[model samples]
Target: MRLRLKGARVVDPGSIDDYKDIIIFDGMIEAVIDPSSPYPPVMLDSSDPSSVTKGLKSEENDTNYSEAGKIGVDNFPVEEGDTNYSEKGKVEASPTVSGEGYTNCSKEADITEIDLAGMVVVPGLIDMHVHLREPGQEYKETIETGLKAAARGGFTAVCPMPNTNPVNDNAQITAFMVNRAKSLGGTRLYPVGAITRGLKGENLAEYGDMKQAGIVAITDDGRPVENARVMRRAMEYARGLGIPVISHAEDLSLAGDGSMNEGIVATRLGIKGIPNAAESTVVMRDIALAELTGARLHIAHVSCEESVDAIRQGKKRGVNVTAETAPHYFTITDEAVAEYDTNAKMNPPLRTEQDRLAVIEGLSDGTLDIIATDHAPHSLLEKDVEFDRAAFGIVGLETALGLSLQLVNNGSLTFDELIEKMSKKPAALLNINNDIVPGNPADLTIIDPDAFWSVNPETFFSKGRNTPFAGYHLRGEVYMTMVQGTIAYHRTDGGQ
Candidate 1:
């Protein structure tokens, strides 16, 4: 089938000149033509005899024509002795109309022409960290529903964390997630392996076996490996196996009995707080372990200024350490928790304005490598309880792009830079495909960066509606998402 997406401003971040008009045929890009090209034949109007002249007049100023004045009534090929014309010039008959050709070509080719006049066509997004809540807790989010949310959010692929009820520690469970996601979900789900058996943080999970089973990375997630020796050993083992150890940077001892960030807000609300040191201390220790063991360490949802500084130093010192931050960490602060909103409650809990500014700075300066949704879903019954009893997560897969674009459009980040952080950088981090060229998998996202939208939880594809940004006006929206050249999601109705 031939599909032509014409007049789109293709933003391929890997290139120097980011915008171009691309032609795709048979699930691959045929060519990237300049929008100024005049090769694509314009359809002639059969109803009006004067239509051909109008078409020629439109292209009269084209650079392909040297003398625009040469085209006139004498040059136009009109029907000989036609009553519409005063005189007959060199009569040139209209091209033959082939009914059979039109039928056979239209049927066989299945040409789909899309005029994306003011849209930006970018490589489909990849999220390296997300929680689909499948295998158990399907009431909160299933593999199918989570992928649907991902597609709506312009994500072509997502890596689901290994924190299910029966954690994805063994080869069988990892295989189960892969199969279910492939057969039943819209977005590609790369299964991550648990760092420890059942995420107990005591005994290491089957690292080599899980890697053989196709798990992308290993993480305890929410449950950090607190013991330095245990973490060091896990890192060394994972490094030997050529996989990364993702840490949920937090010292639980310092975070004990804490419900929010240690700040003026927490104090005013009379809630125990988890100090920024809880996160930074773990980041510092992990960087040291990574340097010592030469292991790839990834800090998950880093939410503190000092932690960013630690990661910056780790990179400067040539430590194999990378980090990702969630949208909430950069966009929201402890002030949002003033009303005891459980939606704002998340692990590595929302910190002060200083920390928020620090996260934005990290993202802008490349200290933070990727922007993930961390789309953890919990049932309303779980999140609607007391703030202390509420689950530590918020549904974000459906709103990740919009929130990221809010930063870009606000001049905090460039569009190409945002695409790099969201799509190519995440794929590179996970060692996945990061191509926008021909013959590559057609995982692409179509975005209207200027489209304004507001968050409405009722419209969310995920089962969870625990977003703190509900009803907040945001710019930019995903119009369509494709995975492997198949349309995964399309917003037929106009977005906000």
Candidate 2:
């Protein structure tokens, strides 16, 4: 079907001040035309109560095209001066205007002509950090279930972490995950290989073979590689294969018996604390290793001002490094642990307010490349345990976009900048095509920036309901998500 989306304010981050109407056909964009351009000879009818246009037929050749035809102006409003305007002694105009000489055609085009007033159309988001626990931990999160949540969250593609019960360290497991996500799940999945055998941080995993099997990157998330020699060797091997070694920076020696961030909040709560040095020390070490080996290194879930300072200084030098921080780290602080809420207890635990502000500053000043959810799902039974013994992650697949818009709506960042950080920058970092043009894949997200709604965990698509923002009101919800030209998710709450 040919879809002529008229009068859409397209937001393309690749260009400056670029907004135009677009035409999509055969699952790909055909043209970016002006809003007032003439309609094609054949157009679909949008007047019917049903939204979809029915029966593709010719409109110009039929003399009775104005007889409530399905193809020509089914219910399009007649222009002004089109109703019985007589030129002195000319024939009287019909009750309705015909298609002839309709220069300034009605803003209405067809059912296929989607009106995008007050909306921003951006390239679909790509999350380089996700944990779709399949092949072993289906109860926690399967490929199909995780992709559904990703679609609702407006992510067109995601890179799954390799930390399952049987870790994805071999080509066979990576190939199986790729095929399962492609055939069963709707969202695009890029499998990440393990940095070490079984994530034990002793023996290096098959970096060369995994890259050959089409893995985008390698990392042992939730388990940092503590051995300097092993991590350095892994980095050099990954560099040889042209893939980045994403590091979950942490020094277990500093994090001894600690469950949360080290600060006044932890002291007041009488809980063990993990000092900020634990993360910053690893960041400093990784930067030195990257410099020594000349390999691409990426830091994940970077928190605290020290880590940011280390990354900033490394970039100032010539070391090839990139980093991403989760939304929780930027919005929440260690003070949230005052109530002993395990949902707020995440790895690289939330730091002080000063550190949170540092993360925001890093993102705004371009020191941070992307914002990911780190969307790890845990069952309710596992999360409802004692605060100290409970899990260390939260469900964020469905709330990442809403929380991001809150930042923009509150004057922290611009709309175009948010889109770039969420969609284009991550794609470029992971070496993927950021397509938002004609003949490109129909991967796009439609967002209503002004829409306001409160988050409810019961309404989440993921089985995990361990989010801290559950009753918090947020603005800017995703109205529709399209993957490969197919409607993957559509809001039914009329929030749009």
Best by TM-score: 1
lDDT of candidate 2 vs native? 0.78
* TM-scores, one per candidate: 0.86, 0.85
Best model number under lDDT: 1
| Regions more than 4 Å wrong, model 2 | 16-18, 39-111
Cα lDDT, model 1, residue 137: 82
Clash count of each predicted structure: 1, 0
lDDT of 1 by residue, 35-91 (tens): 543222222344644332332223323432222122222122333444333221112
Candidate 1 residue 272 Cα shift, in angstroms, is: 1.0
lDDT of 2 by residue, 146-200 (tens): 8888888999888888998789999989998888887964678888999999999
Model 2 lDDT at residue 422 = 88
Cα error, residue 264 of model 2, in Å, equals 0.8
Q: What is the C-alpha RMSD of each candidate to the true structure, in Å?
A: 8.4, 8.2
